[model samples]
Target: MSILKRDQGGVPRADPLGDAAGTTALVLALNKPVYPVYVWFLAESAFQLSLLTALSMPLYLVVWYVSRIGNSRAARLGLVIVGVLDTLAIALIFGRESETLAFLFACLVLSGFAFYRCEVWLSRGLVAAIFFLFVLAESLIGGPLTPITAGDMQNLAYLNITGAAALVAFIALRFPRQERMG
Candidate 1:
C-alpha cells in the first residue's frame, strides 16, 4: 500500500506537514553519522561533538516511525522538539561563533509554521519557542561548552549550512500544491 493511503487502523497517513517533518528527520538521521568524517582532523573535542550529534539519530528515527503510524501531529511535534533541542545543544557547545544558527533556526521556524496550518495558536507557540531558544543560545548563553579550532568551526559550519538547506528544500518540495482559486 502507498504511504499516503489509510492504514489498517483507518487513520489517514498523508499529512503533508508530517511527511515533510518525518522526511527531514530521516535525512538528518542518515547524515548525522557522517559528521565525524567532516571534522576528523579537528580537535578531539570537536570530534566528540560530532559524535554526540550522531547520537540523536535514534530520536529522528522515532519521529519517522511516529509519522508512519498515522500520528502526524505527534510526529511533527517530535521533529520540532528534536530539532530545537539538538540545535540548542550544538549552539551551547559552539557558542556565538556557530555560523549555522541562523539557517538552522530559520528552517525550524518554517517547519513550525507549516506543520500547524489549522492551529494558529500551536503554530505561533512553536515559532515563539524556536525564537526564544535562538535568542537564549545566541545571546544569553553564547559561550562554547568545549573549545574548537577555527578550522574545525568552519568545517562544521559548512556541514550545517548544507544540511539546513537540504531540509528547507525538502519541506518546500513536499508541501502540498493547492488548487488555484478562480
Candidate 2:
C-alpha cells in the first residue's frame, strides 16, 4: 500500500544513501522532535529529554577519533557504542516513567535505532521485523505527542490517543514504500 520502494536487501533506494525514506535523517533529528516538549516541560521535566538529545554528542568525538585513527571500522564501532549507550539511557528513562508520553516517544526512537544497528550488523530479518514494528508503532501512535498536564494525563487521555492515530496516518503517507527506493 505504501509508495516507498526497497531493494531485495530490504534497503530503500530513493536516497542515494539508501536511506529507506530518510530513516537516518529523521532518527538523527532528536532535537527537533523533542524540542517543543522541552520548551513546555522546561526544567522540571526530569533530565530524560536532555539525556536522549545528547545521544548525538558522540558525533564530534567519533569524528575526532576517526580522523586521527583513519579507520572507518573504528568510526562504525564508535557509532555502535553510542547507540548502545543511548539505548541504555532511553531504557532508564522508560523504566522510570511509563506513564509519561514523552518518555514513550523517546523509547520508540531509541529502540528503533537499536533495531537498525542490530540488523545492519547481524544481518537478520527478524531485526528488520522489529524495526518495522517500531516504525508501525510510531506511524500509528506517535506524532505531535505530549502530555500537557496532570489533568490531561487522565481526563485528556483521548487527546494523546487521537494524536497517536493521526501520527500513524501521517507516517503512512510520509514514509511510503514508493518513495523509499528510486
Q: Candidate 1, TM-score vs. the true structure?
A: 0.78
lDDT of 1: 0.67
Candidate 2 has its poorest 10 consecutive residues by lDDT at 16-25
Taking the tens digit of each residue's C-alpha lDDT, what string does model 1 give over 1-182?
A: 33556545443456676676677778878877876776575434577766776777899899999988867878878887888777767666666665557555654555544553345566678777777767666667665667887776776667667766766777666655431011
TM values, all candidates: 0.78, 0.35
Candidate 2: residue 114 Cα off by (Å): 14
Write down the worst ten-residue block by lDDT for model 1: 173-182
Candidate 1 contains a number of clashing pairs equal to: 0
> Would you give me the overall lDDT of model 2?
0.37
Residue 52 of model 1 has an lDDT of 70
Task: Choose the strongest candidate by lDDT.
Answer: 1
Candidate 2 C-alpha lDDT tens digits along 1-182 = 53546556553333322222233223334333553364335432333333454555545354335524444333333333454344344434332222224323432332233222223544244335445544444344332123334433332244334443444444344433432222
Clashes counted in candidate 2 amount to 13
The number of the candidate with the highest TM-score is 1
